[model samples]
Target: MPSETARELRRRLHQQQLISAFGREALRGAGLDGLLQDAARAASEGLDTDLAKVLQHLPGEQCLLIVAGVGWGPDVIGVVRFGTDLASPAGFALRTGAPVISNHLGGEGRFRTPQLMVEHGVRRAVNVLIRGEAGAPPFGVLEVDSRDAQEEFSESDVAFLQSLANVVGLAIDRDRDRRDRDLLTREAHHRVKNSLQIAQTLLRLQLREVEDPEAKRQLEQAARRIMTIGAVHERLFSGPAIGLVVVATYLRGLVEDLRASLGVGDGGRPLALEVTPASEEAVWDGDRVTTLGLVATELVTNAFKYGRGTVTLRFEIAALTGGGTLVVADEGDGPPPGFDQAKGGLGMRILTTLLRGGGLAAERPPEGGFRFVATLAPPPAGNGG
Candidate 1:
């Protein structure tokens, strides 16, 4: 038979394992609410308490709101609030960074209206403070309750509760940091998209004054290219994650816009743009999206202006055999045999410069037609690798 001390040690080890498992699972959970509830339940188990409650300070309401609770009736869970009164045990615990303990809730003078505790059959209680970092206001409080009046909590119990409070504080902070980063990223994408639109508008206005038709055409194409990139940013701004972009959806929208901009009439008679995917999904960063948009704009513009027939855009992604390829082909009379893409017109020169700057190679397919093939570079380290 195991001694009481051995059994207690075993129980503690099991509780610690449970807490660790809960923490890992909570990180993978969807929202903060679920994590908070799971943390409270785990803390209650680790602390050997019948009930646990987590109260978060609501600055706007100027009060502490119950974020999670275990073993508490709905009435008590939703009805209690810790006001700003320093005399209150909950408030005092928060201010002093000390756990408030009441061996006998009904008889403790400092216990705030023990009638509520009696009504809930909570005879012994401990209140743990969860303070924010360095001079910041306290974030919240954690309370544990026991139904047995004689169940006196020891100093080790207080220490354990404090450790649990620390874990809860860290979890809350991590969730808040994640949410803040996501919001900032979305806002940045929105501002960038708006700036791109303004630039595109300015380019169009400048094109109106140019006497050279080719220059004007290039300017208009540049504006359309900017708009296409802006559309990708717009999609990101509307989504929860701004870092990953959907390649297929973005390309389809860009193709539709190009058809409209080039005056490809309706009734299914637009520039025959077809995109073949090497994978079901290809996600890219903002810079890559911008480069791809510029390259696509140049190819589509060339096809509409000079290609004799329909145009096709193919997107392919292959695993590990190095970089992927983006091929834009037009069924027009192929570019003059042995024509150099680098020595072409101003637009072609700009396209070549952009591709090379992006660490990509641009070339015409030797078989026929005008084909712009760009190799996709590997993503930088520490980015979802």
Candidate 2:
């Protein structure tokens, strides 16, 4: 039979392995609070500690909030807050950048046990700093305590607790990095989008003065194209940084912008631009948004200007490829018989140039109306589901 010492050694080694795994799994999930909470539970159960907790130290505060805890009743985990005065071991470990342990809590005179600990009958404890970079602030403390006065903690117990705290520090660092990246993404998106919007507004203002019909038409086309780029930034701004974008949410806003451009009561009738999304989880990156925006704008604008009735925009999963298809169709006169499309002016040439990079086809369906279909290339490399 194995000696008692050998068995205990194996158990603690197992505990460390389990706790380390928790950190890796938590990094793949969301939210810092829940991650810390799970660490507390693993520490408590694996180490046979009566109370385990993960503390969060606010920048300007002297107290640590119980962001995650195990063993405490529901009323205390998130609801109660405690001070981390130098007199308490948690504060001592944090300040000294080292772990602290009290084998017999009440007998120790070096630190004062808070009243909450007294009320809970905690008689022994060990706390370790959830250490961060050297000279930087600590993440928080991971504390394990024995409520029963007879329970005692040895140096190995303290060492195991320190290892658990280290795992938690890894999780904290990852969460902070993700948050910083998200902030930068939002900031960059806002700057680019805002600048484009300002330029677009200025162009619209200048448009109010031009008198020649031909010049006005050319300027109007430019403004609409600028709006397409602006919409790309807006879509990217509102979504996650992973580069996958929701299609319906993006296109709906573009549709509204087009409708608003046509002044109410000034146009022949209030245009009802209907948008039907297949509602798949298809995602597109910024380039695709700008390209499709221009394609949809040209086809739909042409429909409203020359075709007739309500314009319908549809996005659906393409039947054949790893991409989606965007269709702009309308109930209107087909292109003039044998019309000279090659000479169809600026917008037509622009549309043709854009499509060569994508996939495009046009048809006057035997049943009637005009339809222009474009295939959005599969999301940028590494950007798809």
Candidate 3:
């Protein structure tokens, strides 16, 4: 048999191990309910007890609600309530901000054993207050229980429970902070999107009042660029993936919008736009999406103005390197004689600027059509990986 001193050391070591594990989960940002449930279980296991619970104080109702627990009936957890007065052991710890050790609840005079505990044949229990950050209201109480009549709740057990309670408080606080930051980021995106939309609307009004073909074309191009940015922001705030734009969804939407704005070809027939289906769960950062959007708009616009027949836009993922390729082609006799990418018009200048280091491939496909291929580097690590 282990000596009394060695046995005490073993219990302390076990308690420290439980505390360390609970602290890690809390730091990992587990949700509030999950943290509370795990805290209850940890408290019970730390003390080798039969049951444990975490009660959230509802000041409005003047009662402690059993929000999480271990070894309790489904009806008891989330359904049981205890008064806040000092007569109750858990209440005394919560109301007075002190730990309570009730080892002789059956004959105790200091506090009453809750009826729910009595029904379960509980003979001893310990309670500790779960406090919030400084200046914040107290969260509630954490309690562990034992059913063995010979079981004793010691001061060491109270210390372990308090340590677990502190970790729970910090986790809840950090979770709230993270939620607040996320909300603020979403709000900022929404505001920027609305502002861009307003700018696009103003540009469209200016385009309507002008009659010079040159000026009208410039304004129209500017409006389209603004629209692309606005659309990207809309997707960022509207979707579940944070700071990411789905490659397929974004390109498809952009092609449809451009088709609506640019209208039909010289043959009085609707312009044909073919978008290849997305093959992977690939995503890109906002800046990359914006650059790609602008490049696509320029190439597609040029195809409609100079080329003829169906315009096809294809996206391919490099399987080994995780990079991407954008292929924009049109069924035409290709660019007129002597067309150079680095020495062309405004559209060509924009394309060259955007694809400077990214590598651009322009050729007349074997079938006698113009094709512009842009290579996109993979997104940074931790984004859509």
Candidate 4:
């Protein structure tokens, strides 16, 4: 048999491992209920106890609600409450913000044993307060209980339980901060999309009044650019991640919108748009995705104006660098041989401008159609992408 000292050391190590594991999940922003459940389980396991629970304090009622627990009947968790006064075991920890240990609850006189605990035959319990933001009311108590009448809890056990409680507190604060920022970001995107839609509507109205073909075309192009931006905002607003854009999903929606507005392609055929990487994933930065969308629009518009048949858009990610290339191809013959892309039409100019002075490479594939390639810089890392 191992020495008592060795067993104690092993227990301490196990408790530390539990704390680290729970800390990781909490920092990852797991849902509040999930965090509470995890914390309760960790506490019970770390203390070698048979039961554990996280009690959420209700300030107005001066009571604690059993929000999460382990080794409890279905009728108890989420259905039981305890008074938050000095007389209650867990309540004493919450009210005084101190750790509580009751090794002999049955013989104890300082605090009353909860009726549920009495009925369950729990003879020992340890409690720690889970704090919230400074000046905010305490969240509630984390408690570990044992039905084994002889089981004992020491100071080190209290320290481990307190560490777990601290992690829960930090996770609550972080989750709240993240939600607040998301609300602000969504509001900003909403306002910008609304403003852009208004501009697009005004441009459409002006387009109907203009008689000059050149001015009318310019206004239409401008309106389409604004619409492209609006479409990006729409995608961002609906997407789960705040700053990341799923390339395929956004592009498919954009292509559908363009097809609706532009009508048929050459020879009066239906306007056909094909996007590679059919999967709804492949995320990238929002701003870069917006730029790619505009670039695609200009290229697709050029294809419809000069080329014919289906317009195929392909996006390829550079596995090593994260940068990628956007290829827009059409079945029709490309610009006449010897044509200068840098000095070509307005669409070409806009493409180069959107790409930050970078130019596209024109190619005639062996399959007998035109292909334009625009290389993009590697998207920035992080930002939820």
Candidate number with greatest lDDT: 4
lDDT of 3 at 268: 45
The per-residue C-alpha lDDT of model 4 at residue 202 equals 100
> Which candidate gets the maximum TM-score versus the true structure?
2
| Candidates in order: C-alpha RMSD to true structure | 3.8, 2.6, 3.0, 3.4
Q: Give, for candidate 2, the lowest lDDT window spanning 10 residues.
A: 262-271
Please rank every candidate by TM-score, starting with the best: 2, 3, 4, 1
- lDDT, candidate 2, equals 0.75
TM-score of each: 0.83, 0.90, 0.87, 0.85
Give me candidate 1's TM-score against the actual structure: 0.83
**How well is each residue in 207-281 modelled by candidate 4, as lDDT tens digits?**
999999989878987888898889998888556578777787788877877775566534564444454453345
Among residues 3 or more apart in sequence or in different chains, the pairs in candidate 1 whose N, CA or C atoms overlap within 3 Å are: none
Clashes of each: 0, 0, 0, 0
- After superposing candidate 2 on the true structure, give the runs of residues whose Cα lies further than 4 Å from its correct spot: 27-30, 240-244, 264-277, 319-322, 339-344
Q: State the displacement of the C-alpha of residue 350, model 1, in Å, after optimal TM-score superposition.
A: 3.9
